[model samples]
Target: MYIGRFAPSPTGPLHFGSLLAALASFLDARHHQGKWLLRIEDIDPPRSVPAAIHRIPETLSAFGLEWDGEISHQSNHHLRYETALHQLQENQCCYYCTCSRKMVAQRHAGVGYDRFCRTQQHTGGAVRFISSNAELIWHDAIQGKRTHAPASIEDFLLRRRDALWAYHLAVVVDDAAAGITHVVRGYDLIDETAKQILLQQALHYQTPSYAHIPIVTTTNGQKLSKQNLAKPLDLSCVSEQIAAALAFLGHPLPESLLRAAPQAQLRWATEHWSMERIPKRAAMAWPGV
Candidate 1:
């Protein structure tokens, strides 16, 4: 059976952006007659707020979306990540770099890492993995073939100065470990796909299908992110929120649910989910309903 996930960081309430992602993954998994899972990506404890951490699951339940099996948290899987890191190290694919942020930026004007530490390993610095020969020539099941210049990226930190596991490392490891078959997420993470695919290849894990949905941008074309202080989702209008999300996917609601409640709308969504109806566009401003 196919498996997909909607993993969110606990940094804020379940806003429009989060709702869209959750609905997309849930509906897509149902469309494929597959199992959908929820993962709490709370590895970065510094950014994880209490409300952000607890309300996501509650919000999903309120929106009438349910997942299969136990929910996974990144914080609880550090041992597995450590094992992966150790495996990469054993293969000599990753190296340690003690260069400070200021030093690295001074060398390359804030481009990707300059590979200074690729050869000269350092203690008490970040750990970075070297890239493989093949990249930029892969295709995502949803987005199709994509290309990128290797020089566009540097050996970014897999482990940071404070010894926190980087997002890049934990995500790939988690997805593979969880047996995810498809990844339906926001377009903001599109670029990360290459890095993810690269890691998948390095670790010899199967690359899942990737579908980057349009982000709920602002009128000024800015993405609705935690930093911009996007408004929290109005739980009071659950039906409207689900309808808006369906509209974003380019699958207009059938007349049957026009007067139905939020739970009804979500039920219809799961029953009639259609990947072909999803908009192929890369980005669009939120309808702001």
Candidate 2:
């Protein structure tokens, strides 16, 4: 059976954008009769709020999402991350980087990561992973074949000067450990799929099918994010919010049954989910859906 995950960082509550993602992931997993799992992406400890972590599961359950198996937390898996880092280091797939954004900007010109420190044998504080021109070529199940120049991102950081395990590394190891066979997430992260896929291939892991759902955005067209202070999805209107989230993912429900039992509503959704209904575009502005 296929396995999928809805891994959300515990830095914030289940915001509308987050709810959209969870609902999409849940539906995608159920549609395939796959196992659905939840992961608390708490690797960025400094940004992880205490209250938010406690609230995520409650909010998800309020929306009728019950995950399979014990929930996974990235914070608890440092050794696994270290192992991956060592593998990358041993293969000469990564190096130390001392270049700051200002230094990179002045020197790199238009290219993002100029690999100033790729050849340097410097150690401590900063760390980076090599990105071949081959890293630019990756595919998505929904978006089909995709390619991009890695000029803006060459030999990027897997560990910052602060010495934290980067998202790229943590996510790669987490999915492998959890046996995630499918990944359904927002289009904002669709591009990052290539990076994750690169890491999976390097670490000798099976690549999963990916479905990039459109991301919810503000009236100004910016992606709804914590930086914008978009309020969390109101669990008070649990059913309505879930239905709205489903509809945004192109799984509209009949109004007569919008308030029906959560499991029943989910059942109807599973039976009717259509990838074609999922908008092929990126940033989506659902005015009142």
Candidate 3:
């Protein structure tokens, strides 16, 4: 059985870019007759907005992207992350790093981590996974063959110095727990795949198929995101929004279906969804952005 997921952080309300990822994941799962799960990545409470958590699902619902089963939140899975961390520690696959971001940058001239604490017996700091120096490679559903050089990959954080679970660790643990078989997300996340694959290998979890769709960007080459203050998805124009998002994914609905209800548009899209139509690129400028 195919299982796909759309895990988004509740840092802000869903925007046009958010819809792109959600719609892609939803359509791919539906087209394959698989389950689509929603997971709120709220592990970092300081950055999460309480209201956004409630509004994300509401927005997805408004766009007719209903998920299977109850939604899961990262905040509800601390013990699982802790267990995974402990397993890595037991296997001596990770070490505590006392070096701060500034310290690493200053030492390595802005390169990746130098693994200075891997052998220094550091304590009471962030946990860093011992990344392998071998080349990491994988076949992406959309991006085709991808490879990360040994030098490009480095020891990544599993836990933050503030005692917060890192995104990579939490995401890998949650996806494995949910039995996710496929991951449809933005192209910007493609680089993180290697690190996540390493985590899966160390934890003995199955790696899921990945399809990174082109992200929506502005004319000036800025990805549409809350950080860039991308406008919140306009709920009043639900039909148009769905149509636009589907078009961005390379499955533009017919003129008659363009003005259809949100659910109607989604039904048409699902029935005719074609992954091959999606542009094979890292980013696409939004129309009239």
Instruction: Please give the ranking of all candidate structures by lDDT, highest first, separated by commas.
Output: 3, 1, 2
C-alpha lDDT values of all predictions: 0.83, 0.82, 0.92
Clashing pairs in 2: 112-152
- Residue-level lDDT of model 1, residues 57-150, one tens digit each, is 8888888888899989999999988999888898887899888878878888866778888878575577897875444776655556778875
Task: For residues 94-183, write the lDDT of model 3, one tens digit per residue.
Answer: 999888788888888756899889899986799999999898899999989999987578899999999999989999999999999999
The CA lDDT at 95 in model 2 is 86
Best by lDDT: 3
Please identify model 3 stretches exceeding 4 Å from their true place. none
TM-score of each: 0.95, 0.94, 0.98
Question: For residue 115, what is the lDDT in candidate 3?
Answer: 84
Model 3 residue 127 distance off true place after TM-score fit, in angstroms: 0.2
Report the Cα RMSD per candidate.
1.6, 1.7, 1.0
lDDT of 2 by residue, 1-289 (tens): 8899999998887788888778778888888899999999999989998798889998888878899988888889999999999998888888888878998898857756777787778876577877766437656666677777655345657887888889989998989988889898888897677778777877889888888888888666877887678787776777787788777777789988788877778889889987778777787886642
Task: State candidate 2's TM-score.
Answer: 0.94
1 or 2, greater by lDDT: 1
